[model samples]
Target chain A: MYKKPSSRRIKKFYAPLNLIPILDSVFILIFYLLMSAQFVKIFEIGSDLPIMADSPPSNMKDALNLTVDVDQDEIRIFTTVNETLYKTIPLNSDGTFDLTTLTGILATLKGRYPKENAIVIRPSSLIKYDDLVKILDSVREKGSGKSSIDLFAQIIFGNLGG
Target chain B: MGLRFRGRRQKKQEFYLELNSLMDVLFILLVFLIKNYSANNLNIPENIVLPHSVASKQINQAIVIQLTSEKKLYLNDILVADLEKDKELADGNIITALYDKMVDAKQNIKYKAKTLGDIHGTDEIVNLLMDKNLPYKYIRKIMFTSQTAGFKEFKFIVEGKE
Candidate 1:
């Protein structure tokens, strides 16, 4: 017992320390961070396309460009200049969008602002895909694709699109 | 042989220390680390196979959206886009609401130029994150919608888990 107590005192005073464990812990921490981090790519939302009548105008002053708003049940085309909906077309239960009024209004706007190349399209989150496609086609046709309405155009998608 | 046996016996002094408690502590530490190993970091879906790029640069951001194999869109856990658009999927209102959110983001960028990257990160470069199965028609529709809503610089996000 006396020898055992003396040996314990010697161990407490002069025991050798091992550093391998500390080094192992450090390596593990580094590996963990690397494995847990999403370092390669980012995540993004898939946004749906929107429909509109006329192409967007470019470089225009405030309230001068045409704004097309596509709501859940209605397609509203209004002139920012006049501050009123020039045409409001509702979505048919069958899902086919007849924007004859919207087309005429867009033609009128194009004629009025012949050089205007910017048009803003704001589509609701719940508009049908086919309907949205039809609207985009109409807008492109009216713009003639000669002038890019992209100069000042804006396409706004909803929560679904975000 | 007797001398060798004596030397061996002398070297092998009968001393034992119970390391069971120390092993128990090590096991507890190992379990703790394993439990914390998975932090539920964002994972890119298997269906939305991102386009491969020579550029392996990483983009780290908080919000991420996922598009599935069937084209069902998800934002975090919210089902943003209905997969079954066969019935009727008019997304005008969706686009409008999305536009509002984007505009808010843009406003934030304008307020803090440092955060402008947030606007362009995914909005301007979307092609980087598209699966080969994605149709060109879908891409065009999104482009038209974005242009209509005033998004000049756009981003396309794809899977990146290299």
Candidate 2:
């Protein structure tokens, strides 16, 4: 230390101070915020619910409505106008829903009827909310052979009974 | 080798700290985190497990309703009603208490908009944050109550994936 003082007194020039430790601390802080940040992606599924209006119901009662019936063992798809069944897909062995077939069917239906954008999801009272959400996810989008696109995005939450 | 080392040591008597490479790595990490970090202010309750979806749009400013797994209703994080407490309330597809709560919320928004000179359009958007395992009856009741509360447009808050 004493020898360094003599050399400093002789030399007029000195090296600049190192700021690496300060930079290191700031970088550490930045990393903490980066890792702790939620950065969550929140998406919305838009729907229009029936309001209590002063006027009577509109003439659009004959509108094309694609209804999905959620059952414990099977999921039934059909149209309101024609009460005939469109398809019957049974649940998986583990009791979880199978959306692969649902996606294919909806894609074909969407291709045929591009104007029909409304899909009413009427889950049974016994069905779990998770299953209801899974069904909605399946109908919300479809693959168009080339790329994935939105299917019946207008999700209508059906009320009790018909 | 000893001769070469002695010559090199004599040439540079000053101590040099090489931190440029370490700083470069830290800077790269900070940039990556900053790019992907989303500034989300959505204060979803810890107990509320949002449904998952492949695609969901970013949430906008709206009336937020949170329903926990216990079938508890929360308006803007305020606990308004607990379905488990009242069996009668759970039986009906439309909940009157929730409707009243929403009406109050709508009135507050309307008053704020009026004072601020901002006009809300014909439709009012309601954001829903519901648990993934609750029954469909509770969901239907919530939707019906929201409709009765005078909100026409609705948005479901879901965990989004790219």
Which numbered prediction scores highest in lDDT against the true structure? 2
lDDT of 2 by residue, A57-157 (tens): 46445545588788878888886466558998888888788788887888888887787888877787777766777788789887433477778988887
Q: Tens-digit lDDT track for model 1 on B42-155?
A: 556666656532222244332334455576655444455543473233334233433344455444545554644444333332222334455433444445444554555434
Candidate 1, residues A122-150: lDDT per residue as tens digits? 66645543355446445534443346332
Compared with the true structure, the alpha-carbon lDDT of candidate 2 equals 0.76
What is each predicted model's overall lDDT from 0 to 1?
Answer: 0.50, 0.76
Q: What's the distance in Å from true for residue A132, model 2?
A: 1.1
Query: What DockQ, on C-alphas, does every prediction get?
Result: 0.09, 0.44
The CAPRI classification for model 1 reads as incorrect
